[model samples]
Target: MSFLKKLKEKISKQTDTVTEKFKHGLEKTRNSFADKVNDLVYRYRKVDEDFFEELEEILIGADVGVSTVMELIDQLKEEVQRRNIQDPKEVQAVISEKLVGIYKGDSEFSNEINMQEDQLTVVLFVGVNGVGKTTTIGKLAHKFKSEGKSVLLAAGDTFRAGAIEQLEVWGDRVGVEVIKQGSGSDPAAVMYDAVQAAKARKVDVLLCDTAGRLQNKVNLMKELEKVKRVIEREVPGAPHEVLLVIDATTGQNGLSQAKTFREATNVTGIVLTKLDGTAKGGIVLAIRNEMDVPVKFVGLGEQMDDLQQFDPEQYVYGLFANLVETEEV
Candidate 1:
C-alpha cells in the first residue's frame, strides 16, 4: 500500500485510548484551528479563489509560517483541481491530507529516537531556558525506564542555578540516577563523568541536559563542541541523537530557536513540549517545513504519560477530528 493509505489505516486502527488522548491534548488547537476551517466551509459553498484566500488566512493565523503556508496553499490548489473537488466541506479532508504530505515530504518521516542496540545511546537535549527542557528529560527517562531500559541522566547545565537539583528531583521522581558535580563546574567535565558512569553501568540510554543559555552564540557553540568532543572521545560516535526541545506555546519564537540551535549544533530531532497549552499547534508543520526537523515527541498534557511519540497522522486527525467528514455531513 502507499504511504498515505498506510497512514490512513493506522489512524483508523488506532485504539480509542490513544485517539482520545490526542483529541483531549489538542483541544485548544482544535478550537482555534479546526473550528475556523469548519466555519470557512460553512461560509463558502464552493471551492474558489475566495475559499483558498480564507484558508490561507486561517493557516497563517495559526502560526504555520508564511513560506510553508504559501507552499501548502499552492499544493492544495493543485490537489483540488486535480481531484476536481468543489464543495467547501469536501475540502477539509484534502487540507489535512496535504498538511501531512507536506510534513512527510518525499522521504519517510521517522519519529523514533536513534538507539544503539549493542551499546549505550547518548541523547543530548538543548534549548533556551524556560522551554521545559528539564521536564522533557524527566518524562523521557520515565518513558525509557517504563520500557525496562536502563536510563541515566547527566546534569550538564551547570550555569543555571538549581539546575542540577531540578534534574535530581526528576531523577528521584522517575527512579533514575543522575550524575552531577558542584555548580559552576565545567559542563564538559560533567559530560565526561556521565559518559564514564554510563559505560561503567552499561546503561541503555544516557540523556544529557545542557545549559539553556542561548544569548551568546559563540560561547554556546564552543561549549557544545566541547561536550560533544568529550562524549565522542569517551564512546566513539556517541550522542546518537541531539534532540532540540521547543515549547509549543512560544509559537514562532520556538521556530527561531530551532533555527539558531540547528546552526549551533546537529539537532537530529525535535521534542515539542506543552502542546496542550497552546492554540497555535500548527507550529508543528512550520517546524518540519522550515527547520526540516522531525518532531520525535510531543507533550500533550502535564502528566507523566502525556509525552507521546509524535505521530503525524494522529496529530492531523486530532486537529481536524471535529471538522472532518462526519455522518451528519
Candidate 2:
C-alpha cells in the first residue's frame, strides 16, 4: 500500500520502452538530486529538524524553486507529525508522492495535442532563438508523420537568415513539403501562404515556425499578434496550439523565457528540450507549479523519437528509478 508500490503498479501498465527512456534520460538528475537524498537519508537515520533543513537545501539545489521547496517541506513536516514517522528512509516515497501531487495539483489538464477531428490542426512553435525551437518542430513533424498523418511545415521565421532553409532541410528529411517565402519577407505573409497551402493540400497537421527574436518585446508581441491574427482569419480556431520551446540546460533562465512568451501570446503548452542534458530536471516542477501551464512534451534525448509527451508519474519514477526498484512495499 506504499506510494512507491502504487507508482510501480501504475507504471507497469505503460510501455516499458517509455519507462526506460524516462529512467535513462533522468540519470543526470538522479545522480545529482536523488543520490544526494539517498546520502542524506543514510547520514541521518532519524527524521528531525536538521534532517528536514538538509532535505530542503537538497530540493532547492535541484532547482525545485524556493517557494515550491518551502511548500513541499511544510507538507512533509505535517505528514511526519500526522503519521509519527521516525525513519528518514521512509520519507523517500513521500517525497515522490508529493512531487507528483504538486505537478497535478487540482487541475484536470490533459497533455495531449489539440488536434482537429476532421480539419487541419495548426501548431505554432514559439521561443527565443537557439532554444532548439526549429529542431523541436522537425521532431514533432516527424512524430505526426510517423503516426500516418500528412504533415506540412510553414517557414514563418523570415527575419532570421537561413531560417527558411533550415526548416526546408527538416522538411526534406521528413519528406514533407515546406511553405516558405524569401528571406526578410513579412512572416505574417508566409503564414497566410502556408495556411492556404495546408487547406489546399488537406494536410492533417501544419507545424508553423516563427521568428525567435526577443530583442524588443513590443516587436515580438506585435509580430506574434499579426501572425496569429492572419491564421485565425484564414481558418477559424486555427493555431490550435502555441507551444513554447525552452532549453532545460538553461535552468531558471528558461523559466524567465516562459514568462516572457506567456505575456506575448497565449502559450497553450511547453516543449522542454535537452532534458537529458541538465542536472536540474526539477525545473519541470517549477514551471508547472509556478506558471500553471502544462508541459505537453519534453526532449528526453538526442534521438528523433526521444521527444515524448510529458507524464508526471514517469518523471518521478525516472528521478528515483534506482530506489523505486529496490524499495519494499
Candidate 3:
C-alpha cells in the first residue's frame, strides 16, 4: 500500500477529535505548502531536474530550512530514480514520507512527558519572553489535571514584570496552585521553596517557570544553572524535563533561540507554540532536524485543550489532509 494510505489508516484509528485538531491547526500551512506542491505537480507531469528544483524552492519557502530542504530534495531524487517514477503526482506521497523520516530520523523517540512514576515529576520551562512559555505551562497543567494528576506551578520568573501574576492567572484558570514569591526575589530561592512545597504536598507534577532574560547570555546561563542546582539539591534526579518553548511563528529565529537555550541548560524537548498562526509550518521539521530534540508538545490553537502531544504521522497527515482524504488506496 502507498504511504499516504498507510498514514490515513493510522490516523483513522486515533481519536477523531485529535485528528481534526491537527487538520484544522495545520490549515494555514496546508493551504500554502500543499497547494503549491499540488500546483507544481500539475504544471510538471513528469519528475525531472527542473521539477526537483522548483520543489526545492517551495520547501525552502515553507521555511523547511535550506540544509534540510537540500537533503530532502536529494532523497527525493534518489527515491524517484530507484522507483523509476515518472508521474509527478506520485512524488507527493514520497515527499510526505520523507518529511516524517527526516523528523523521526533513525530512532524512535518518544514525545511523551518523562513522568516519574510514584514520584514527583519536575518539568522546568525555559524560553525567551513572549514565546508563550507561561501559556504553554498553563495548558500543560490543564492537561495533567484533566488526566487526574495533581499538579503545582512554580513562578520562578521574578525578573519579568507581572510574570508571577500571569502565571497566577493561569493557575487560577486551571484550578492548580501556584507557588511564588515577591517580585525581585532570587529565582533560585523560589525554586527551592517550590520544591519544598511540592514535596510536602506530594504533588504528582511540578511545572516550574523561569525568567526569560536573553540579553546577557552569561547571566541567563548562570541563573538557569543556579535554579537547576537548587532543584537538583532539593530532589535527587529532579527537573526531569527542561522544555524550551519556541514560537513557531518566529520561524528560523526560533531555531536560534533553541540553540541558546540548549547551551544554557539541557533541553530535553521543545514546545512549539503558535503553530497554527504560521503558514510555514515546516519549521517543525527544521527544528527536529537541526536541534536533534523532539518536540514534546505543540500549541495548536488558543484554546486550553489545544496543546497536544507531538506526533510526526499526525503532523504529516495534517499537512496533506486534503490530498490524503481524496487519494485512493
Candidate 4:
C-alpha cells in the first residue's frame, strides 16, 4: 500500500485494542474543538463569518496557540476565497492540510538512535509528573536494544514513591538490567552508580530516569543540573542527551513545561505523549515554532511500540487525517 496508508495500518494494528484510549482522549480535545465545529458544520452548508469565529475559538482552545491559530485561519480564509469553497467538510480538509504544512514543510525529523564516539550514548529523561517519562525511557531502551545494542537503565527517580520500581518494571518487561538506588536516596548517587556500571560493563546506552518535580522551576533546574554534573564527573560528557517528555494531551501547558525545562537544563529534544489523543496535535508545531526544539518521539498508545520517533510529515498528515474520515459522531 502507500506509505501513509501503511503507517496508518501499522498504527491501527498496534493500537487496535487500545486506540480507544487514544480516541477517547483525542475526542475530548478543546481545539478545532469538536463540539462547536461539528455543530457548525451540520448547521451551515458553506463558509460563513460565524464559522471562522468559532473555528478560531476551537484552534485556540485546543492549545494551537493564538498566533498560530490566526495564521491558520488566515490561510484557510485565503483558501476559501481562492477556491470559492462552499462545503464544510471541504473546509475541514483545508484546515488539516494547513496544519500539515506547519512543521513538516521541508524538513524531516530523524527518529533513529545515534551512537557516540568512544563510549556508549547516554540519555537523561526529564519532565513533570504524569508526562510518561519513565514509560518513554523503557520504550526508548527497547528501541535501542531492538537495533542490536546492550542497554542499561538507571532508576534515579528516587524521591517519588515507586519511581525506581517503576523503572525496574520497564527494565523487567524489556529484559534489561536496571541499576537503581531506593527511594529517598540521592538521585546524583544513583546516576554515579549507573555511569560507573555502564562504563565497566560497556553498555550501548544508559538511560537515567529522574523524578518529576512539582516544585519551583529553579529547584527543578538545579536538581537536573546536579544530576548532569555528577554524571559528567563520573563519565565525562556522560549524559549525551537531555530529553524532555511532555504529555501532548496537556495541550499548551506542554509548551510551558518545555520552556521551563529548557531554561532549567539544556533540553536537547522532546517526546510528545498521547499523540493519538484529540488534543489538536497542534502543540507539536507550537513547540517547534516557539522553542525551536526538535520533537524526537511521540507516544501513540500504551504499548512499547506505541512510542515512536516523531516524523513531522507523517504526524502532520495523521493529525488531519481524522478530519477527512467519513465516520462521524
- Give the higher-lDDT candidate: 2 or 4: 2
lDDT of each: 0.91, 0.92, 0.94, 0.76
lDDT per residue for candidate 1 within 127-202, as digits (tens), equals 9999999999999999999999999999999999999999999999999999999999999999999999999999
Q: Candidate 4: misplaced stretches above 4 Å?
A: 1-48, 79-89, 105-108, 233-238, 277-280, 322-329
Taking the tens digit of each residue's C-alpha lDDT, what string does model 2 give over 1-329? 77877897899999999999999998999999999999999899799999999999999888888888998999999998899999999898889999999999888866899999989999999999988998999999999999999999999999887889988888988899999989999999999999999999888999999999888999999999999999999999989999999999898899899999999999999999999999999999999988999999999998989999999999999998888767753
Where does candidate 2 clash, by residue pair?
none
**Tell me, what's the RMSD of every candidate?**
2.1, 1.2, 1.0, 4.4
The stretch of ten residues in a row with the least summed lDDT in candidate 1 is 1-10
lDDT of 3 by residue, 94-192 (tens): 999999999999866889899998999999999999999999999999999999999999999999999999999999999999999999999999999
lDDT of 4 by residue, 201-255 (tens): 9888999899889577777878898999998888777677889999888888888
Ranking by TM-score: 3, 2, 1, 4
What TM-score quantifies how close candidate 3 is to the native fold? 0.98
lDDT-wise, the better of 2 and 3 is 3
Root-mean-square deviation of candidate 1: 2.1
Q: What's the TM-score of every candidate structure?
A: 0.96, 0.98, 0.98, 0.80
Q: Which numbered prediction scores highest in TM-score against the true structure?
A: 3
